[model samples]
Target: MANHAKAAEYNNTSISSLKGADRVRKRPAVIFGSDGLEGCEHSVFEILSNSIDEAREGYGDRIAVTRHRDGSITVADRGRGIPLDFNPNEKRYNWELVFCELYAGGKYRNNSGENYEFSLGLNGLGSCATQYSSEYMDVTVYRDDYRFDLHFEKGENSGGLKKEKCHYPHTGSIIKWRPDLEVFTDIDIPLEYYQTTLRKQAVVNAGLTFELHDEYSGETFEYCYQNGIVDYIKEIGGEKSFTEVQFYATQTKGRDREDKPEYKVKLEIAFCFNNEINLLEYYHNSSFLEYGGAPDKAVKAALVYEIDKCLRNRGKYTKDEAKVTFADVQDSLILVTNSFSTETSYENQTKKSITNKFIQEAMTEFLKEQLEIYFIENKAESEKILEQVLVNKRSRETAEKTRINIKKKLAGNVDITSRVKKFVDCRTKDLNRRELYIVEGDSALGACKLGRDAEFQAIIPVRGKILNCLKADYDSIFKNDIIVDLLKVLGCGVEIKSKHNKDLNTFDLANLRWNKIIICTDADVDGFQIRTLILTMLYTLVPTLIQEGKVYIAESPLYEIAVKDKSYFAYSDKEKVDILAKLRGKYTIQRSKGLGENEPEMMWQTTMNPETRRLIKVMPADIEETQAVFELLLGENLSGRKSFIEENGYRYLDMVDVS
Candidate 1:
């Protein structure tokens, strides 16, 4: 009985309706898509869209926008001002219908070509909804040789329309408003948003100018494109494009379905292929379609079909080569599609995408025909496009294969300490305290293992000299057991910079197993050569370790001096001379032996002890200079390497091993 009573309490009285302003104010996301910064930005765009529509309709050629420091925005245009006079048809003032009502606008009669043949403000929600969501709005209109002013506060009319006789150069509308903080969680729209939106609008609406004044930054910007997307594409592709820019345009009539009304569509496309740059943008009715619902599908289908057909006809494919995909074409394609229609079916009020079926079909057919004609007319350009697209396809296929092989090789659940042969791990699993010593040869490894603090120090031996990673390809480097085992012990993957091998890169600095990677070797030529090889491998495969200050070199003494009961170590010739000068009584000095010949205590005191050992942190301040040196020494710049050796070889002659 109690449950039945509770359910019956939900009656008609409990389901009250939201009133005029409350409909949008209370439930903003339902109309604006978000009650956050995105909603605020959309509200601004809504006001801007009206100005853009007027400009595109030949009413105005310029629009001015100002972002105030107090979080208010002003959009002024030279279009025939919005009519706010009485309307007998609706039996109400035009201001009431436009500022207070929903689903009422001049664009509804677009099919008759009476007003806004191709309009961006299609939903009629832009103006009223934006007005409803603002803290305060002031509208000024100059039309009919008179000036009209209206003000609203908190979605309610504050003052009746104020009309006055005035003389003005051009008829226009100006609106200034600040988004309500109560309705939106955030309203601090960024300046970049204005710049990007205005730039895109200018690109689509050719010959139209947009001026932006940012009071916060005290900066003003202007955007205009005389040739629209063609000019924009050239700006992006630059002079290095392999093919010239191609433009195509057509106008047609279509309907989404038999039940839907027919409408006119104007399509324009501009494209070029560049090896160094690639971009794709879509716009409809001067509105940037970020998601690109219909045009995106149409472009991908047409380009892939046409390119694949050409490759087959030209005998560019192997016996069983798969057809090219949209990604392969997109890898090098720089394209822009600007289209407008009398009627549009936007996915939502925000208008990020359009889902009209007829638009897709029309575009696909038009693009296919144009591409066929272009290929037949320009053989050289078509051949170049085909070759580059084939190269992209082959490179994608190779990257996939390499990615799979690398994943398999690097995958396992087995304990790394047990799987990696001859690799000794420390007892501590704490990453911040753990250290790794990469010693040269088995003899040095044995000594280091005996001398290191087993609680936090691990050791790995590099037998002989490993492959020079800077000169060797990835496949050869990975095939070597020494490098592979070392990498496995380190527990971080490689960083691949090649365009074709991007998929093979799986590096994560957080997964590195050690806090410090110390290279422990003798102070002789062979030991130095082995150390350089190890460093080259690290610089090639995992430069992030060195960049993050985790790599170090354990400095060994060059001379050992014994006086009475104390032993002193000298790391350089100057240091040796200084130590001999400081000694008072009889002293014996001798050259330090290799790492393998040092006793466990001597190794600990000189190479492994945290308090007494000397360690040089390896960090590159200028990566470009470091790269140049590495390339001259180990890369395939043979002539450069020869010149460098001729100039600097004498300095290293004493360290060189002729035996």
Candidate 2:
């Protein structure tokens, strides 16, 4: 709860001998990668990784995350308690040193063969770095019949571990801490984010069991999957038209000489294809390869080669196109590629991958040889997959051609005015100092155009409802007249006429005419629909525009509380009610139904003034979810749209306008 400044004063340090702490603080990017939300997530990963490492060592199985009522999180694991033995000469218990120190875990020396093969946790700096970035932390260790506790504020230990009386038959460790408010500007961690991640981990770890409870919100859940990646494939693939199929294979060869035991390479690929377009792949190292490295390339190459060979032999594909590119066969595919190696030197302290290139090559060769035999023997399934790939190839070509033609027209500027004429052009040419007000209907558009900022403000009055971009691809999208005009006005040079087109300039290189695109719609269902349409287009075609902080939606008051001569604008019903209570005898409240009904001065005072206007910037929390929603709403599937509306209609905000 305390501001980050005080915490940093105690935690921040520049000592050179503290190698792990220095590395993390100096090159935080190397450890957590960024100072943004993703990097904050990395801190959670660091903690979870340590717990998982215990499981890999065959010492821990159950991990629980509890969100305290006060907003702090506790992560506890039942693993072999951290070693407490002391080197009499060093005179320090290893458990205390490891918790307070950096780069201090046993997996570094391969004490646990499971993790030595593949890991995804910090060497020693993870916990220490987390401590540095947190305001307060407490770690408890249960080892050798003794319970010990260490407390720290920032990074410095406030005091030594206090010997604790045994409370129960317990082992492993428990860490309770709150991230520093200064380092993490976001004080509230969304429960859904944690839920999504922990559920995913449970799915990936297979036999691992995880329990989570949020005391703040009274939410609790448990996750475990005995089938592991196979269950993951089914869950991610959802109700898609694909059955779970796992390809199992392995290979071995002597490491040094004939006397050496054969070093083995094991590979497991679980995959399924749906009726969608892009590919989804989850890679890991022995249940930890977060992203596949050489191992991935080997397996994919073999899989493609085998499928291509089968297709060609069955007279389904030509020998010329028999070399299948990974992308071609990945249409609507959900895949998991996991590999285990006895020897590795991955750059990451977490050891997420096996870097040895030789093992990758070996895996590829083994797959190519064995997969060829399997597919040849199971002729029916192989032919079906080959046919699907061909269909995907054709669809891809058509989409590309459409994209090219649209871009050509946009760049060529061949009178792309099917809708541009409807926009009320602004006279000013200066872009940075200017802004555009995109309003719904001619009524609100007329008010905005006359509100008198012609020198900087342009008004675009959109007709009826705009296109929902989710269901359409790039080609079908450009066909919408309203969408094309909006892009042109915004200085987003449209793809058109070939790059060499030297004639009448179609591309508007004129210094961008507006710096802000503000959506001002009526306070009604139709208005919300129009705003969503515009937002969808920006999300798909010009995501960078939003990311760069250029798009915003204007907040128009729903209720205009007019008591006698004085007027107060209320953006919500609650505000209107509160305002009415204060003016109990002096006023009669009037709720304005729409922007058009409000006089020019009232509109400027409540919704247009730079000082008073309340605007909401659209930020996509999950790109995948946005994409899926858009596809369902706009795609040709009427049933999907109906289902979505029925399921989520309750979430829609009620809008009111005083007319």
List clash counts for every candidate, in order. 0, 24
Question: For model 2, how does the per-residue alpha-carbon lDDT over 1-659 read when each residue is reduced to its tens digit?
Answer: 75654443434464445353445544555666666565666677788777876776667778999877765778999987666557464488775566567666555644335444445453566777787677788888887777878887766677776776575566888899887666664546778867877877786676888999999778888888788778877767677644346556464653424555445555666666666533444444433455566767776788777777776677875556535566667765677765554545464654455565667777778768766766667566666677777777655665567666656545544443343776776666667767788888888876776663667777777878887776565566677777777876676654332222222223343434568889889877778889888887777666665666778999888777766678888888888878877886666556566677667777677767777788887666776787787778766778998988888876763532235
Candidate 1: tens digits of C-alpha lDDT, residues 558-632 = 999999989999998899999899899999998999898888988999999999999999899998988888888
| lDDT over C-alpha atoms for residue 493 of model 1 | 90
Question: Which lDDT values do the candidates have, in the order given?
Answer: 0.91, 0.68
List the pairs of residues colliding in candidate 1.
Answer: none
Residue 151, model 2, lDDT = 84
